[model samples]
Target: MSEPTPDAPSGPPFAVPITVRGYETDTQGHLNQSVYLQYAEHARWSLLKAAGIGQQDLVGHGVGPVALETTIRYLKELRAGDETVMSCRFRWGTGKTFRIEQTLTTADGTVAAEVAAVGGLLDLTERRLIKDPGGFLRELAADPGLLDR
Candidate 1:
């Protein structure tokens, strides 16, 4: 198994901007913690697009990976008017899963949140875990070479 590397990325990591609407906040005047997870989801999809992987392709191939688990570490609180740049890197697991390690950062440079997700390859037609598509798995495995350790 290729180890999960600790990478300090050059740019925003998976830096994407988000506008915090009033409703997304709690009485504390900061973005509700739950909202940060939502932001990470968007960034994950964007990474797939960047990787030329799409939901359609997974379903059409009769295979899919579901977000079976996640871990989120909150570093700093964010409020309205703050823009966040989040970066995500795809991880291919030796076990039965794939993972994404994501970091959300403030515009200037501060970790707002960290998200780690575990998803497993599924035989969607049978609704069970299965070996991933070899070609696609290779692509994800190849991704870490692009990371900065």
Candidate 2:
């Protein structure tokens, strides 16, 4: 797995750098479309890790994140050996659900794609969306400010 690298200190959105791999490319020599989602997912997890929250932490809390909807806007194409940066930003409103915005940009500052998703914390046992997801995240996050919109 790739390590998380912060592009800025004390920010609303957290970013991680990713280097495209040969195996991740499509037959057309471009990054696979599905891999974009994986990149965004990695960024989200890395953000949680940076906030001192881990998968176990969420599981211990009886909650896990679930994506309700996702939309991707593709711009430039990425190929193997390309170095890109993926960013994750959480937008918390007053509810059990939240919105996450992410962007993938090549090393030359070209925007490869943009991803927007609606997600929520799920109660593992109850198998439903948990109430006060943001509050729960804030309670678990070492730096609650990082979750602020």
The lDDT values for all models are 0.69, 0.86
Residue 70, candidate 2: C-alpha displacement in angstroms: 0.6
Per-residue lDDT tens digits for candidate 2, residues 1-149, read 12122232244468899999999999999999999999999999998988889999999989899999999999998999999999888877667787888999999889999999999999999999987777788789998766653
Candidate 1 per-residue C-alpha lDDT over 1-149 given as tens digits, one digit per residue, 9 for 90 to 100? 34443343334354467777788999999989888788988887666655566778667777776788999998898888788887777655445666678888888889888899887778877888765332354455334333322
- Which residue pairs come into collision in candidate 1? 13-87, 14-86, 14-87, 15-86, 16-86
TM-scores for every predicted model: 0.77, 0.90
What is the Cα-based lDDT of residue 144 in candidate 1?
32
Query: Worst lDDT window (10 residues) for model 1?
Result: 140-149
- Model 2 CA deviation exceeding 4 Å by range: 1-12
Q: After best superposition, candidate 1 residue 56: deviation in angstroms? A: 1.5
